[model samples]
Target: MADGDKTIEISMDRARLDLDYCYDFIAASYWSAGRTRGEFDRSVEMSFPVGAYCEGRQVGFARVVSDQIAIAYVADVFVDPDYRRMGIAAKMIDALHSHPELKRVKRWLLATADMQPLYRLHGYADLDDMMMMRLDEDARNRDPLR
Candidate 1:
């Protein structure tokens, strides 16, 4: 159940496990991933996914890949802009923090460009020794076609 005037109910249950609605929401939110529904569908088909709904419509989501003993990486978290500031993002994070399978993991990691304070509420922190790196995609694309 959700709090206050918010009409949505937050849940941690697996999404269709296919990125369909997930990426639709992602593309809608970020204008990135000129995605086809098929791509999202295939991606989540094999992963553990969670989603939120408002009036039975998906509004928020988060997912984790975990091993019951050691670690979990939380990824692809989002809530629609119209739903922002309504505590939806925090609720989604809380659901992940409280997940049963995730509890056994010794540690959890997540990557985000912003929203630090929101995540911090669930005890998330940045590790000093870990500097992040990413392959430059444009450079990768410049390689001669195979």
Candidate 2:
């Protein structure tokens, strides 16, 4: 599909991913500050990656970590600053939701600091009744190899 004079394509093909752009964007994000390129690459390798391209240049991205049946975690969703406000992010999310492999997922989860409104528009609601917990970073830091 074309957005204005730019042709936009959202695809599931990992080969189309621009790793440098993705890693740079994610590493600068508030949630993933200090994330290494190796870590980002590993995560992309393990997930269902979606790339949004405008005029053959990657302008947006998202990844879904899923078991292909029960649940999926959407992560690292972003649109290049120059491409914002043009509905690219929403289109990427729509592509993910329509993916056949994720059609049977019973649950979808994502954590966003300030994008609740956007997610809510996509049918995600705050899990107000559920307790969300995380292992302390100290526990992770204590691991010898980590």
Candidate 3:
């Protein structure tokens, strides 16, 4: 954790997990996806999540939804606006891709509106037959906390 340069830390350690800071960072930086604190908390609770830090601050994050067998989806990746282009998210993803828990996964998937080049560097490509769909907001709103 230097002035502008930073190192990433990985933790399943509950004491080291900054759930509040992570929630705030995602809420402020990502609006198009309209993510909320509860969604962030639930994802971490249910999946393999990694949070990226810059100068001891939560800045970027992503998670893997996998059985560590056939499929792994990389989701909810975002970096703070002030720290963009510093390669923090790339490093975070690289760490996860190389993680031992993820070694068994044969297929990695991600949905990105941009950043295709970054993913391609790690051997991800366009899936021709795959189509993605989501439930309506009203349907999603059925859950009191989403």
Task: For candidate 1, write residues 1-146 as lDDT tens digits.
Answer: 55465587776555333346667676675434676776666545544567777876787787776664456677678887777878888777767666655555556777776766776666776554332222222332332323
Off by over 4 Å in 3: 1-15, 28-36, 128-146
lDDT agreement of model 3 with the native: 0.65
* Candidate topping TM-score: 2
RMSD of each: 11.3, 9.9, 10.3
The residue-by-residue lDDT of candidate 2 on 1-146, one tens digit each, is 66678778889999889999899889889988878889999999999899999877899999989885656788999999988888888888888877866666657888877777777787777775321111122322232321
> What is the C-alpha local distance difference test score of candidate 2?
0.79
lDDT of 3 at 68: 60
| Pairs clashing within candidate 3 | none
Clashes per candidate, residues 3 or more apart or on different chains: 1, 0, 0
Assess every candidate by TM-score: 0.70, 0.83, 0.71
Model 1: lDDT equals: 0.63
User: Residue-wise lDDT of candidate 3 within 1-146, one digit each (tens)?
Assistant: 33344655544344456788667766766332587677778877877877766556677677788776556788777777776787767777777776666665666777776677777676777664332222122222232221
User: lDDT score, residue 129, model 3?
Assistant: 32
TM-score of 3: 0.71
Compare the candidates by lDDT and give the number of the best one.
2
